[model samples]
Target: MATAPAANDNARPSRLGPFLRSPAFGLVLVALLAAAPAAAVLLGQPFWLTMATRVAIFALAALSLSFILGQGGLVSFGHAAPFGIGAYAVLILADLGFTDALVAFPVAFLAGALFSGVTGTVALRTRGVYFIMITLALAQMAFFTFTSLSAYGGDDGMTLWARSTVAGQKWLKNDLTFAYLAIGLLALFLVLGNRVLASRFGRVFRGLKENESRLAALGYDAYPVRLVAYALAGGVAAVAGALLANQTEFVSPAYMAWQRSGDLIVMVVLGGLGPLHGAIVGAAVVLVVEETLSHLTEHWKIIFGPLLILIVLLRGGLIARILGGRRG
Candidate 1:
């Protein structure tokens, strides 16, 4: 009888291995970095630049969710709360004369962290569908709260006339420069997320994802670990939200709506969850498809809905195993 291969031989590489070994990932990153500058110089179109930046920003948000769903096994339906809160943080601070990027970014991050900690405390206590529903409900609360802030735009939504200034510089005011800055932030978060997945804390998070009971029995307090991971994910998502407000020069309760949260989840799953880079791919695919479909027909949703269903059914798992193999 033929002996089965050793378990180690069939095992997935450590999460970091894909980043270190995959030439394709490196090439894509380099291409994206190069494209930002090329688009500015060659195209000279503000519309294209803005669209690209938006893709990057949302990609960052999706990546944040991947950390929780892909690695930590926490399906937070309220992830958009931090994202919207981050956007609101920038706008609220901008309204109060805190237009500096340095100040706005930190404030946005803090808001996300605080929101996550409070929500995670309750949601984390439950598992499966209960956790999902509680998070969705909490996000709705945030949405309603934002709508009630009349001093801000309230239901009308607020428009930012200018992007935040960096230091004493007007650098971010330039569309191309701002796009580069957004890309840089995306790169930073992607690298940091990869590092986290390689650390001891990340190991525990992944363990919990695979088997919460096993991790708990192994003497690890799964709650605190998951909570920290959730908070970190929220903070990272907030960073994306902050950049988003800067990119669009606007803020609204729509940012925190349940639909936005659902879209974030779609991006994570579409990109092939767990691998940080997959989020970027998924975002690109979704945005490109949406734009294309919208141009072809006014009721794009009629076509887009079926397309998404088809993609999900054909793709099977979150990430396409046939194309990328399993995430490290």
Candidate 2:
């Protein structure tokens, strides 16, 4: 028995030999994951933690956009609609005395999925610029509808009196705990997204992105696959929106504004697209840059606007190349 145990332990090392050999890359990844949270905790700065939480939330939203734009080859300009809807869903639920995260989150996801299904059916009918325009229009419609809802605070936005509880516990009331929870969700979604993109369904989506007509000739229905992906992306974005609402303790039509949708796309592109992790990097970069630039000047847009153009022209392709070099 002792001899057998020694042999089994030796085999276990051999099984992991390849992974252990790639120590540098693994170590770097582990360090990167640990650095942000560790810094936040060590610094003991509430503002930095809040900013990091905001970045994670926005990154989750950008990741959702990447699923549709980068993978599904769907340029949806209305992505913010689901995000806003999810936020509003949480707000509404809180108002209705259902402030538990366990309840609010699932409800927000379902609402987003349902909205995506209905909106996708209409928006998917067109492709290219038409699709973009239609999505933008649909998002505008949603924004206007929200603006008219006087009961929910409408244009002025409603403040959330409290954050959602967890299983009758006020766990999320703490900013630090809530921030870690947001990070956990971001990591969870990223892993789930990676698995999804490697699955058989992901293969079909990639094929469709490469050539939809060829996929159809091969007896696959591209529309349904794309629609399902679109809905799933919307659902994920809605989850982010719910978190955002809880973080800010506010809900308003501005959440669904067209500029917000554009910002999401910008984050996706800046992060190099396709890879889920890129979204988080992009969000952090954009937010940090914006914060720094804003602090530097009251009219920072005067400087930031041209700088962004230069980045799009020069660094955009470089980012894509660095992040797997897959073009949409």
Candidate 3:
């Protein structure tokens, strides 16, 4: 009798199980991304390649946020701190005569991870709105600290004299090569993020989101696991920041601003707030929409603010209808 019941349970799949398990969705997304550069080249629109690179960078940053916010339920409002720190890391290294990506990128990643680890130790002690406020405060402290660095151009920002080189080669100086590099990094991390989220560590981290008490009862220490996830997210966001620095050839204290963090949050939420791919979609849509709206009017935010609210209100139904899944 027990065997028959277990068989019946196994036979009946959850409503969203197929949608989640299907590879068609991810394959389509990857194919579309891989085609963008080629399409731009064939169409003779180099600007599109630049735009695609920008989208990829932001998507990577947003994906990092999703790793914590979506999977671990750690809402970090100060995410831009690590991002800006990464950008500045490149600038600082360049000042020290290290303009190679091989040298700068890893340093930037470590800087970001270190900053996140130190701050998350304290921030994780709080929960809910308190956590958000603490992160914002910590990020503001970083922002002010950067502004005080007159040697690095202070509040006015500084421009990179040259983009980082690839193995002492000037490959990154070419827009096409740089765009592909950004896309390649995004693809690599997307795979890594998926793998991390599927591992045992991911299971426990997500459990932190769903029920900390239950997990603690099961002999799990939430602090160390959450800190590791937070640090990893910060490191990834820093890499995106480094790419952004390369793309713009500029670094600013403004990158560490609370508003920048809010923009990151918007990207994650706009992208559907859970899946990493949603961050990519959200970054692309937000950038495209911002560009379009800016052309339409200088007061674009006046229109965008309400539009975002409406989307947030309707996102659940819209997503369920689009995915053809029962709303859980």
Candidate 4:
């Protein structure tokens, strides 16, 4: 009864193949992030807890960019405008006696949304390279606007006297608590983004990306829809900015520099632009690599530049492999 084994049997895929292909892979990424603070404590590397918090904040920013860029086909080079606006929202609010996250966060979100909505109304009217340039110009305008505000320390930047509290409690002052809070926010946004992408609105947004002409023919006015999505993305990014301000206890014009927006784009590209979770992975990888390289030498970018070029040359195969999916 011993039949010869089929030739194809040996080619059976590993169990990991399915897991990697499944949505659970994204969950695992989130779980690892959630565990980072505790793991850092266990290893006696408390600095890593701070690093994880930074990673989570940047991931949120990148995820927001991914929302508009990946789905709506709106590549905003001025995305940092909202981010910077958010930080300033916190700074202004705290200065005016609103230091609670409960208050500052919503204000930051609305500030970001308002800025994005106003600028995106014009920026989204263009397409291709023109759109990119407009966003860059708009963001630079914001950079200079902030730099000229001498009252908020302008070019020198300003420091927060104390971190924003959680509902009037100083709970966020604790490193571990802050790290977990950041991770929790990132997880919540990832879930919401996934849901949005699966909804009818997401379908139209995606259609706008694939063929706006077709969507237009179908009687969908792409402008308002794109504008709404842009504003939402900006709002989310502003929240990240608020979190960043809290984490560093500082706010500066540089927070929303054009370069920061470029970094967000890179993170989205590095993560393959398919799933929002990839932004989390991309943010972690970029920050960790930069951190490691800086300790080795002052001119980290010399190494980083070529390394990034190689990654781009490879067109994100490394990320795709790790994420267990094809790049979008």
RMSD of each: 4.9, 10.1, 5.8, 7.3
lDDT of each: 0.81, 0.81, 0.83, 0.85
Clashing pairs in 2: none
Model 2 misplaced stretches (Cα beyond 4 Å): 1-34, 315-318
> Who wins the TM-score comparison?
4
- Model 1: weakest 10-residue lDDT segment is 1-10
User: Which portions of model 1 show Cα errors greater than 4 Å?
Assistant: 1-27, 30-34, 315-319, 322-328
Kindly provide the TM-score of model 3 when superposed on the true structure, using C-alpha atoms: 0.90
Q: Candidate 1 lDDT, tens digit per residue, 34-135?
A: 496557668777567777887888888998998898667677888899999999999999899999989999989989988998899999999887998999
Task: Tell me the tens digit of each residue's lDDT in model 2 across 1-328.
Answer: 0111121221333443344323232234334644666587798876788888898899889989988887777888899999999999999999899999999999999998889989999898788889999999999999999999999998988999899999999999888888888877887787787778889998898788777889899899988988898899999999999999999988899999998998898788777655667677678777887899999998978886787688765545444444442433
Highest lDDT model number: 4
Count the clashes in each prediction.
1, 0, 0, 0
Candidate 3 clash total?
0
Q: Residue 300 in candidate 4 has what lDDT?
A: 94
Number of the candidate with higher lDDT, 2 or 3: 3
